[model samples]
Target chain A: MINNRVFPWLDERLGLTTIYKTVLDRMVPKVNWWFTLGSATLFLFVMQAVTGIMLSVYYVPSPDKAYDSIEYIMTGVAFGWLIRGIHHWGATLMVITVFIHMLRVFFYAAYKYPREITWTTGVFLFLLTLGMGFTGYLLPWNQKAYWATTVGTSIAGSVPVIGDFILRDLRGGSDLSGVTLARFFSAHIWMLPAAIIALIGVHLYLVIRLGISSIPKENE
Target chain B: MARSGNVTRRGFITSVMAFAGSIMGIVVGLPIIGYLVSPAIGGRKTDSWIPVGKLDTYPVGVPTVFSFTRSKINGWEKTTNSYSVYVLRGANDEVKVLSNVCTHLGCRVSYSKDTDTYACPCHDARFDRNGVVLSGPPPRPLDQYESKNDNGTLSIRVLES
Candidate 1:
């Protein structure tokens, strides 16, 4: 249903060729399979975002319904299990790939000169990924989630100066309640994701603008 | 062919990073699991104590049935459950509050002045003034509530399971 001329018609104003040259048509030193981890992490993040959005359709943030809604999603909705399964496992895989990608960059000394900001953003992204994991673990409102959160919040309370404040702020009260669940849900679904997206945008732009790092040689 | 379970230095570092990464994940991620269902569900105390009446209003040597209704907002729906407890007042300001439902089959038990026992009509089960089982097919004694008397006012804690 689309005209063949549609692309050029838009490209003339959009400077599609310039973007392609800058982003896709760059030259880089030879590298091995380790370089693929970065792209793999990107792919995993995309998968998680898509699957996570699909899950939010049926997920309820309230305490009473939170656990039951997850059960219903696993059993009641069509292909819901598969979607959640991907989201759950994708979170794990994303963390792995991101870590490996960071190790790769570190070993390659890519963070030395021009890519310091890239590494910084990557580190924050890693922390954000963990943040996503932490916030997401409580969504099911299961026995393990409840006790783990209790112990976890208590551990946070062990901090010296602002420890009590952090624990109370994280829990939203003296005890874990629906208020806490609501707080975590918003951070997991909105705040963390928004920050991750913005950071990813900057990281990718840097990766594109400054090209991938080259492999090192022995005889300097 | 290389040996299985054997890794180079790079592979070794990778595995170490993976392990360390998982530990860091738990340390950071576990705490984010902050707010649980609600503190009211499984908590030390609940605001579910119902005020029955003045302590002196219940006559000594007889169990007085105090009935109350509670409306709770459970998620999306409003559920109201009726609960009743028998307040047994004795000499010297001693008070024993017991759930009026029979322990055997949860059948409502009424105080029978004729027999001087709490009787369940569902079966011929009976409990004496102290709520110990007297006769019939009841398995255990009647359930007792935790009651508190503050300044002549009596209240009982009811945890609906």
Candidate 2:
């Protein structure tokens, strides 16, 4: 065990006093499963970041070579197939896990009153995850991928007066092609990630500040 | 009030224990999660030349079946699988390799000698020797591979979709 010697100036201004720890002790329940979801989500996010980086190293986002590049990984590159497979399944798993975590929070009525900001941030994060999945799906530009995006963009185009504009913005043209792949790649690898990380940081800070919700009064 | 206060103290201690337990759990569970979720994130590489066999063995103007085994490590674990492709030598002397799986839904297609086109028995889809979609529900051309010639051997790398 490592010894932590209290430094001279450390305990003064930052309130290094264990008072906050005591407050957390008084508020949080001991054996509740609801509390596990937050950490689990964080775990999955870290896994996503690492695996996503690994995949980006070999993934070609260009239209001409994207399909072939993926095939090369599957058939020729060292452990490339497995890496791609893991990234694929990992995404599906993240979606499932995030949804389940949301449900847990909802059922516990953890989103009420003081936690409104946290809940709202969480809802945004959830949507971002879905968007990430959607954008990432088209990067392969395979048959399933191509048609799926076509269907997805058509749905976007169905959203009343502005739908066509949204579809055009997404596709960068009338049809899904090279421009669209690059757009999705940028959104998947950069834009969404930046947004999600910032939102997650806020969510966690709020959680730490407010503490996990106390069980609804009579429910115990 | 004394009993209520004691109960609160007990609850607090339990929360602390739970947090500690969760930290341990995360340590143990992360690698498992990593192994399971790593596949879909990366784009696949189909950039290398895969050997299809001898140039002489591939008779001119006929489709010949070729296959190779691919094994890869995902995380620390290794797995292997077999992939097959159909190759045909055209009159122009260019060798073409096409995925045998039908483009519509992945059923195997065959060469109809009389028609000189590849036909999918399941869907009646037809493609010329080059795997071009001649008719039916196939939305695009048959998937093609990048071909290479090695010291009298004709090899092709199947590009992944």
Candidate 3:
């Protein structure tokens, strides 16, 4: 028998086995390539996590030396640039794939009554991915990263009365500096990931619960 | 009849064949897919200082853009790649290298000799002589790099931070 400790009461509370069965048996269609993008995006997330952790081992987040440190990783560390590159490109690609997946849903009108929550949750996840991308881009603190982010956040500062408040919260100051790095670091590593993972679980759960919609025929 | 058993056996064999084909296809296809997508997925490995070129190749009082490659690592793999740099030989004969990025809005800065400044047309921030903030909405000075010259060849290491 499997260890009760492994499965535990949490599994029962989550209804893990039943949920899995319903998802495998009912929801996910044994279709062609259209369904695979979601899994691919999830897989890319795992890749980002692994590569990002490896990079963090050597990344020092400070404006004074963030650029030098990244250079050192790219030049001195064994596989540093590779990890950074993967993190960089993987982020963009994830955003693209998720966008296409959403488009696929929209084109098919899959966001009908029962699936609205799924669509909404997916939208939240999409925004979170973009958040991850934007925040993570600043961690390098290169001129490109620094100036690009400065301009990007300045747009946030244009949101009327609350714009300054939001911009200050984002940069941690009027200028992008040590505090800004810290804020982006925290967002990239902790806050956004936590939010994304939690929502993803809910999203998958809803997908399982609702079951996959029949492929929308053009006429009907 | 004897033919009925043969028909059942044929159906069973066909099902087995399809299942085996799918399993084998997955087994074969996964590694191929992983390999093809690994660069974007895992990242390219990089290391070492990329060499730019000879010092005399750039004239004093002129800005020359040079490019080089660095090796990067992602997990167990390594990749060497090219990146660009903008080097300015100042009027005072001192070599100053800056990232080709504008401080005001992250646009590429171009040398404008008539104005004697690096100007960002995006938002009108201008840096004169030593990358100091002169006008417009730039929060800081343009970035500078550590440069080296040996045997009349000038080389620089570019950082992505």
Model 2 C-alpha RMSD vs. true structure (Å) is 18.0
What is the per-residue lDDT of model 2 for residues A152-213, given as tens digits with 9 covering 90 to 100?
99999999999999999999999998999999999999999999999999998888788878
Candidate 1: tens digits of C-alpha lDDT, residues A20-70: 988878887788999999889988988888778777877899999898778
| Worst 10 contiguous positions by lDDT, candidate 2 chain B | B31-40
lDDT of 1 by residue, B68-118 (tens): 888764433457978878899989888999898898888899998888899
Scoring only the second chain, what is candidate 2's TM-score? 0.63
TM-scores for all candidates: the values are 0.57, 0.54, 0.54
Give the TM-score comparing model 2 with the true structure, all chains together.
0.54
Q: Which portions of model 1 show Cα errors greater than 4 Å?
A: A1-4, B1-161
DockQ of each: 0.02, 0.02, 0.02
Cα shift from native, residue B40, model 1 (Å):
36
- Model 2, position B103: C-alpha lDDT score: 82
Candidate 3 or 1, higher lDDT: 1
Task: Point to the candidate with the largest TM-score.
Answer: 1
Interface RMSD for model 2 amounts to: 8.4
How many clashes in each candidate? 0, 25, 23
TM-scores computed on chain B for all candidates = 0.68, 0.63, 0.56
